[model samples]
Target: MTQTARRDVDPSTGEAAPPAFESLDPRTGEVVGRHPIHDEADVAAVVREARQAQTAWAELGFAARKQHLDAWRRMLARRLDEIAGLVCAETGKPLDDAKLELVLVIDHLHWAAANAEKVLKRRKVPAGFLMANQAATVEYLPLGVVGVIGPWNYPVFTPMGSLAYALAAGNAVVFKPSELTPGVGAWLARSFAEAVPDHPVLHVVTGYGETGAALCTSGVDKVAFTGSTATGKRVMASCAQSLTPVLVECGGKDALIVDVDADLPAAAEAAVWGAMSNAGQTCIGVERVYVVDAVADRFLELVTERARKLRPGGEPNAHLGPITMASQVDVIRGHIDDALRGGGRAVVGGEHSVRPPFVEPVVLTDVAADSEAITEETFGPTIVVQRVRDADEGVAQANSSRYGLGGTVFSRSRGLELARRLRSGMVSVNSVISFAAVPALPFGGVGDSGFGRIHGADGLREFTRSQAVTRTRFAMPLNPMSFGRSKGTVRRLVRLVRLMRGR
Candidate 1:
């Protein structure tokens, strides 16, 4: 590729842009790759082609779509390792984590392709007693085209939760990958294009926020966004101007709870992994921990040991990878400073390297429940651990945040009950965010965490609309409001409603 090809620019505004942006190896400051993307018109052309292709693809029956999806899934499985390597290079996640994410992505793709027809097939519905002559059957139909605004963290796995389902439901997809990981996005589109070879069913656009805004404003049927709540609100506002519907999987201030009867070792292990994995860039990463007052000290000791053992930088074999975005270092440092000033003690690794991308894991204890470290989504390898009066307080503390994303709970007997009580989209009982591994469960959140689900049956239905059709069989003996309506019929309807409602 020429030097001009290795550049990044927002095609919408036509402003001078970065020819190349460097992706550093988190373990070392060495450059991983210099990536570039197509401009605004280029992105628009891709979307236009996808729109034309969707018309023909949608005409095909569900069986044809399923056949294509199966072929794509087989191709992806065969090349999973190649995709994982691209993910690792772009997002700086550990090799194993990248592979794990790919596995889940494949599973979701399989589930969506196999189950869309079942979940979305038309079914007979009662048209109400008043309209007994009218028959109703509701079936889900594709939405023509879908726009996916994805995040840098879990680039492939998270977005595919939406992308795969959208395609399986017969919608052409236009994706804008996070600026930090554009390569993976391009790779995904390229792979799918090869599998189909007939149409531009999967297209990608690369650039900064303006490119993303362009996708939201483009005449797509709906937008599926996965990013911070602050940015999600912007995407929603952009789509609102066009009267377009959007699904946001926004940021989360997720918490982990350790009860008095909890296994201290297991809880601590979960805490360390939940906090520091992917340098704590995960949306559902445990930002705060609430432990029973009785076991708080013991839990802290165990967590600190685990936190210290985790190293963020080395080579491919490193436990943690460096922070991919340069801007996050300051944010992570600010949270640590605020926690220390708020009377929180550094029980583990509070001090970061003060170097380039690599951020050390920091575990703080005695943090005020209302402190920024405890209340906010840090999005780094830092954790705030606090003590609670009991399980009730733990549940309350966890629900206090505006975000209702995924969380974890550890208890001996009441684990399941407490897990359900906490207001979150998904919960892992006695485990650390294991729901992402279970393809049967639905993922996504409510409130500031954003709406619309991904994964399972709900995920498959998100990309389609309900198409209701009524096929009249035999006319009812009593025709409503036709030539046979009378004043006595109206009175009887009111009496029936009152009787049914026990008025």
Candidate 2:
């Protein structure tokens, strides 16, 4: 913990070694691990290797691939704590939270492996009356090679949403993990190698933005990216060169709605946790709350009381953790300052609560709906509570955002009714971030929050392309498709069609 970052030096030349990136411990600024800075050529070679391996992998069929994936899943489950410790050290999150995310990753891996066959296997499809002489079938085929650009937050769980599902669908993967968390990505790749030693189906390339861009342009069949919307646009641009499809999961200004008849205490607790947990680094974290006027005052009181009691620290008992990326501190502070300057006031922690590497929970009220704090994705431990006239107003406020990722609702009567009105990809009723825990539910969003899906049947299909096949079972007596058809034949075909339509 005491050691900071140190560069690799070549003893003979007395100079730095090849370019590389280091993973720093956010808590103490210590260099936890160092990885190579893979350039464009390196990325291309790795993708080529993966492409070569994909043929054998896809040929193994579903059962053999699942066996290997299951082995990898077991290894991850058995060594959960070891990997979680690395996650905790690199991300500055609590050990328990790291373990929780890893558990979800394992569950998703198992689900992807177990259900890939059922979801992707060729199935019989009925042909219409005109094509009754032909047998039709459809199946999802692997895209050969997939490139995954992972995120720093929830590094293991988030990228695995693409990696596991892709591998299960019979595709090889070339992962360019975030430079800030290369260690976790390397560990995952090593574990998979242990499970399936012969095939080099999974590869990890480590670097910064340039490396990610290289991955996008690499000769992979697809690229799955999880990061900011702006970066997603760049990825799409790069992929456009080769017409490679991309799946993007981006930022969100997610909101939580509180109805007039909501359980006030429950809503307050959810609000606090949703806005403050993991130091509010969650992409789908609740940044704003629109409460009904009838219960706004009491709900504000409860939220303020709970938020004040919480604090961020590196200790095991700390309610929250430090901001993983140091640069994001300025963004959080700027949002708070903007809120306060725009006639908004903090109910608990103020702008001064922003300590370096850590920020205390800040609950803001009276923030304007058009303000940056209200409309933008403030990915810090801050919450903005705005009052609304009724549930309809609350819905309107929640829906009025460019990013529709995930949301929550607290209501006794209209929980489901109001949830359906939300314009988000997923919504949880009477809870916070519950939809993400279920492996069956897809995790994705619409608009600027990014498109395509992960972590469900839909996720499995994202890494594949649908293919249709038809076989001629028998030939019809009427040779309608013949090139040398007589006028009598044409008249008979017309009569048959008219008779079929009850002419």
Candidate 3:
């Protein structure tokens, strides 16, 4: 297959054929599947087709849409193992982890389908004393279509955060999965087709960065992106040209804070698992640690013990898996190398830990606060452990990063207080990344971490736009909106305003 967009000549017709790319298994560098590289024209055509499908899908009403969604959900459940196998093959994650991701996707799909009406259906609101003669209502209407650019890590769970909710809100979706996992994206669309079968409510277009960029400017009503912050900016710029709105869920340098009175073993376990799971490709994965001096040594000892024993392989019993993206391997190694060069001590795996696709967990101690390993996202199975004087100092260190995406705090008495201090968008008390699984919590970051949210009530509304409407129930004797008002009418209206205000 052509790596670039250069066309191949077809001998039968003597015409140029579109380019294609291959999705490779990171474990063995073997080709899993090949996908067409959808260009700008192809993306535009898909968006136009989605718009036509969206009108009928939206007219199906909330209850009808939910029924179809429920049918789709059941279909997914019956074929859960099949879909999970596809995820495992393309993304190189262990089968168990792949299954876990599918479970979350199914749960979010159920929640979004079941709750879209209650959360987004038109509802009545009070008109207040001044507008008592009017009936007011606010409804969230579908945006026609949405474009979802997903990541490779947790491919099923992460993209569904936008895809399922957008569909539930009555919008057709055009999904562009990461180049590394295009096969998974295509599989989802095919299964959705089996359930609905009437229209292309969910469409998948595959390729590299150019394909994703094409979707942004393809006239979709909105775009939801999950990737690095740098790429999110580029997507935003492209969407701006078409006046299309975008929701960006970017990378994070998430931190876990350990207090003096915390559960040592649980904190250690959560940290290791959060930082190293799926080869640490999680957008909200824990990357840094700030422990109080009172328990720093104990926490470090426990975390080191847990991280050391973890193994990365394609085996079912392996604690972790290979890095899905090849480019990320260099980024992970750079952070470890920079940290060590800056006088940080390696407690476990170090510069030699990166072994091509699989990187053993690396635990660092006494790392400088401004080191790239602490400031930027590592997105690998490496973590830096820093000691602070107290919980207050720990919060300060955790909030130092420019990215405020998600965080975790392990404290007995002051869990909430410590969690509240971090600048992160979501913080889990005594648990790592707990907020992400809950279908009701808003997920996204502030500043460089990106903007907008996906999941929960907010996520349901993210794919739609709000519309306010009012109707006159009865006419008033005063006729305040008329040009025939007397000079004293203004005085009477002022008195009425005071009366409404109880002045």
Candidate 4:
């Protein structure tokens, strides 16, 4: 067979194959890179390799592991531009935004490495009076190997939330990045190899949804997934077969609430950025806006003005790049059409603005609460604004969604108070999506937004299993734990309990 023929056929089956796929640039639809479409066997083998590597990795202990992680962070920081270039080419995000993402990932890596020892160390605990003769302690142990199926948007920052924390917690990682951004995944694996050449502490597996399903069932101790709610459900179902624990960071229809006493300009600027940035591909991106009627018109005016000034392009001055996923453009357009058809008015760009890869910022007003545009996760540069009687009504409307991920509240005096009333996992008062940038804050949501955290102290513990240890400190005067305990001993224990309770 000719070279071309060989390339088109599977060598083992001697038939046409589908074991390879291409990554395309969203800006021009050009092929960026080609990667293997890993299957179940490939995923299983990689996981086995990770399991082998994890033993030596866990043996290295926190001090030694921290050294390797620190080296990796330093390497990533020095080559931030290079990786940012790959992210830009693969995800069609502006280079500046790509750099911003890399900066956050690097900071998380440093935080994970520097704090792992403090967070995961074995600590002593006082034994209860009932077990006064024993010493109690608890320590976190690595879960062996971890499987992380990452998202296409924010591929680096989102997955690294789990990958960095998992590694710092001393578990080996097998990463299956979104097929659209395999090059970014390959870059991370290559850089990690440079940091710790002897062990495959981090491995990359590339493919489509089937490949992700493989990872979920590949017998890894844990799985961390970031994607749509539908896909998260599938991942959870697959992991259930093996009883493997999973951390899911799924979809969100987050809202930005503007109280009557809020800063109109600041809230407007924040709403525009939070909704339109990254082509509104953020899981925590603002999809709906609830403004008190007292400032609804002014808020709408300010936001529309800002939205009109922003553009999506490959230029430096552009506020956003193209929609990273081509299919998302159709979804965005559908939501816009649904809103307009349902009597909503487009204050800025409308359905015609969605042209394939590029979707101009869209601002809609007076959209029905039950409309798809307001109810669903419109992962595009579009947001719906609704007028409410007061902050109470605004909060009520914002909390009427199935998702409870991240949210924002802009109020000069009642920011914190109003934010506390929102049913989201993280809410930024007087800011937009600021919680994601803080490494010490936990990030995750409830309901359809999914569960488990990816940052902060909780994040480190997610990849580990708690192991409690108890040892006899000395002989007890009366041993209740023994079956040989006399009836008199039981009576004495009851009397002691009653006396302690002040009965």
- Pick by TM-score: which candidate is best? 3
Q: Give me the overall lDDT of model 3.
A: 0.90
Q: In candidate 1, which residue pairs get closer than 3 Å at backbone N, Cα or C atoms, i.e. clash? A: 7-19, 11-40
Estimate the Cα RMSD of every predicted model relative to the unseen true structure. 3.7, 2.3, 1.7, 3.0
Q: What's the ranking of the predictions by lDDT, best on top?
A: 2, 4, 3, 1
Choose the strongest candidate by lDDT: 2
lDDT per residue as tens, model 4, 1-503: 00011136878989877567778888887788878888899989999999999999999999999999999999999999999989998988888999999999999999999898898999999998889988999999999999999998998999999999999999999999998899999999999999889878899999888899999888999999999999999999989988999999999999998988898999999999999988899999998999999899999999989999988896644688988877787789989999999899999999789977789989999887778998889899998999989887888988999999999998888888899999999999999999999998899998899999988999999999999999998999888888998878988988898888756
In order, candidate lDDTs are 0.84, 0.91, 0.90, 0.90
lDDT of 1 by residue, 184-274 (tens): 8888998888898886789888877878988887789999999988999999999999899999999899989899899999999999999
Positional deviation of 467 in candidate 4, in angstroms?
Answer: 0.6
Off by over 4 Å in 2: 1-16, 488-503
Q: How do the residues 266-351 of candidate 2 rate in per-residue lDDT, one tens digit apiece?
A: 99999999999888999999999999999999999999999989878987557887888888999999999999999999988888
Cand. 1 Cα-lDDT: 0.84
Q: List the residue pairs that clash in candidate 2.
A: none
Worst 10 residues of 1 by lDDT: 1-10
Order by TM-score, highest first: 3, 4, 2, 1
C-alpha TM-score for every candidate: 0.92, 0.96, 0.97, 0.96
Number of clashing residue pairs in every model? Answer: 2, 0, 0, 0
lDDT (10s digit) by residue, model 3, range 194-271 = 999986789999999989998988888999999988999999888888789999988899999999999989999999
Task: Show pairs that collide, candidate 4.
Answer: none
Regions of candidate 4 where Cα sits further than 4 Å from its true position: 1-18
